[model samples]
Target: METEQLYREHRSMLIGLAYRMLGSAADAEDIVQDTFIAFAQVSEENVRSAKSYLCKMVANRCIDKLRGSASKRETYIGPWLPEPVITDDGGSLEGDPLSRYVHKESLSTAYLLLLQQLTWTERAVFLLREVLDFEYDEIAEVVGKSSVNCRQIFRRAKRGIGEAPLATPSLQGKTMELVQRFAEAMQSGSVPKLLEVLAADAVMRNDGGGKILAATKPILGADRIIRFFMGIQAKSEGAYSFAFTEVNGLSGIVTLKNGRPHGVMSFEVRDDQIVNLFYVVNPEKLTLLQADRIRPIA
Candidate 1:
């Protein structure tokens, strides 16, 4: 098959892999495009399996990018969060079942944060084996490690992430109901209502990237978080509007101001309570949402 054909067939999958590995859709697309360019230069006869070959190329590029960005993140402003990517049916990956599963599990903000705790090689190995379902030997070939070593690396990555599996799928209706109620409570500045939905030890982390006003550190505990939201409501009474939407495969909200994109928030629910909230308000990170004119609350 021609290189272009190979690219067309595997582009979404490659982008998904890179995005999960690097947690930046923009950087992931660049890496995938570069990989295809490099693939075009290689002799077709030299390739054994096009999918495997392309996967290896994208994996290596992502690892390199991650290694280079480590220092930058150290110096980054505020609480750094993964760049949000729209995972709605037509947004990021293709609509196939496996692709949907991968997007829902691996591309989530929570999982991506856990991935950051892994070393570059361990991240690559873990994703290749667990997320992509590559055989051990295939992973060994892609990451340039022996099969035994790859297993070890995978194990270490799991341990690094506390061996916690991806969150089980939640009831969509219930999750959306919770999100809507939470948004209403915040808008109304109802502390009791907010506390009713939030986990006792709930945590809120905002990523402003120093471009806007945001907490320099995570806001912990439900009471503290409720107070923080109340303060925000007091200061910006009519400045922002929110719409319910699905982000990273879970119910979420998008904040807007005067009809322009402001921020996106994704939540983690456990036992019907909001355990974690990720607010990505950095202007640079909302570019894609603005470009798409994300649906507003009706």
Candidate 2:
């Protein structure tokens, strides 16, 4: 295939891979662009498989970025959340069941955060094997490890991250229902209603990047979370407005202040209750939310 055709065909997949790897859409776009540029410079005859070649380039670029940024992340000002993306199409892979399962889990915020705990090699190996369904030998090629060693890395990555809950389509409707209720409670400043919807062990985590007012540590338990929201409601009366929207393929709310994008709050629902809430108030991370096409949930 022509270089342009190859790029056009593989761009979305490559971006998804790189974004999951690096957790930055901007970086992912740049890496994919550079990968194609490098691909264009090479002879088509030398390329055995365009998909594999491009994926290798993008994965390696992500690994390099991860390695370089490890220390910087350690010194980051606040809890770092993955850059949110609009996954209105459900972000499913167009393949067999295994591919769809992997693609769906890999796109979630919890899974991405779990990945952050892994070493660069472990993350790459796990993603290649578990998400991309690459053979051990193929993963060995991508990460420059022996097949046996790659297996070990994958094992370690799995043990480190454990298994994240998959929010299936069956649960989306119930989850959105809870989201709407939570939004309504917040709008009405009803603490009792908010507590009713939140799980007993509900936790709220905010990533303000130390650029805005946010709890430095996670607010644990339903009472504290309710209090936190109540405080906001009391202090910021009429200063903020919220719109229910889909974020990262899940029910979430966008907080707007003075017609500007201020923050995004995505939920993790289990048993029809909010288990975990991720609030991204960091202005830098809110760029994608601001720029993306968002439709309010009715």
Candidate 3:
């Protein structure tokens, strides 16, 4: 196989893998570009398997980036999440090189954040094994661990799965539908109906970056969630207003007050209802809210 052809074929998958690990699109591109540069420097005769070498290169680069990002993450000043991508197709990214990975619920922002709970190694292991269906042996080789180690790592991650409920129905269709309903209800001020959609186990995670007003801990249960919303609504008398937008593919509602966005909210759905709610009340996270909206606020 020609070197150019091999690189071309696996480029997107490598990048996608990197993005999922590091949670940054820009950083993912840099890592892939670096992978090719490193590959070019190595002699062909010295490289036995081109695909294996390239995949390893990207994975290592991502692991390094994840370490640095995780260390400095708290200083990021708000709810730090993956960059949102819009997708048209409904399948894994392995099919066509031209297909873009959508940030929608199936690959939604909430899911990406959930990926953060696992250790860097755990995240890589899960993405390769569960999402891409890579064999344990292959993942072990890439991650530089034994196949047994890889399986154990994945087992640890799988055990902690569903620790947080973000997207609904665990199905793409149901998630989108529930989010749309929540947005409309928020727009119309239908408090009672909105409460109906929230699950009894519903919990709200707010990231205020310690710079804005927010719950420092996760707020659990439906009744508490209802009170939280009511408190915010009571204060929105010309000082603030809410707008719905798509953030990282999940339905998100952004809060704007006196012409500036103060916070942004995104959800995780389970069993066709809102089981988890995340609000990024920190101003820093809402920097792109205006741009994320379907249309500019009037």
Best by TM-score: 1
User: What is the per-residue lDDT of model 3 for residues 1-298, given as tens digits with 9 covering 90 to 100?
Assistant: 6657877887877877887887666677788888887888888886666766787888888888877766688676445556543333234434543244332224566778779888888888888887667888888888889999999999999886665433343455566677667766766778777887899889887777677767767788988887887787787666655555555555566666775766666677777688878776655444433333333234
Each model's lDDT comes to 0.79, 0.77, 0.69
Poorest stretch of ten by lDDT in candidate 1? 92-101
The C-alpha stretches of model 1 lying farther than 4 A from their native spots are 90-106, 163-167, 171-174, 290-293
Q: Tens digits of per-residue lDDT for model 2 on 192-257? A: 889889999998888888889888888899999988877876787467777776676667788777
Q: What are the C-alpha RMSDs, in order, of all predicted structures?
A: 2.8, 3.9, 4.9
TM-score, cand. 3 vs. native: 0.72
Model 2 residue 169 CA deviation (Å) reads 0.9
Model 3, residue 105: what's the lDDT?
26
lDDT of 1 at 166: 58
* Model 1 residue pairs with clashes: none
lDDT of 1 by residue, 1-298 (tens): 9887887788878887888788777787788889999999989788878888899999988878877878988999989998886555445434433235345454557878999888888988888888888999988778878999999999999889885435346444566788889988877777889989999999999999999999989999999888887778678746777877667666778887766678899877778888889999998887666334256666
Q: Candidates sorted by lDDT, descending order? A: 1, 2, 3
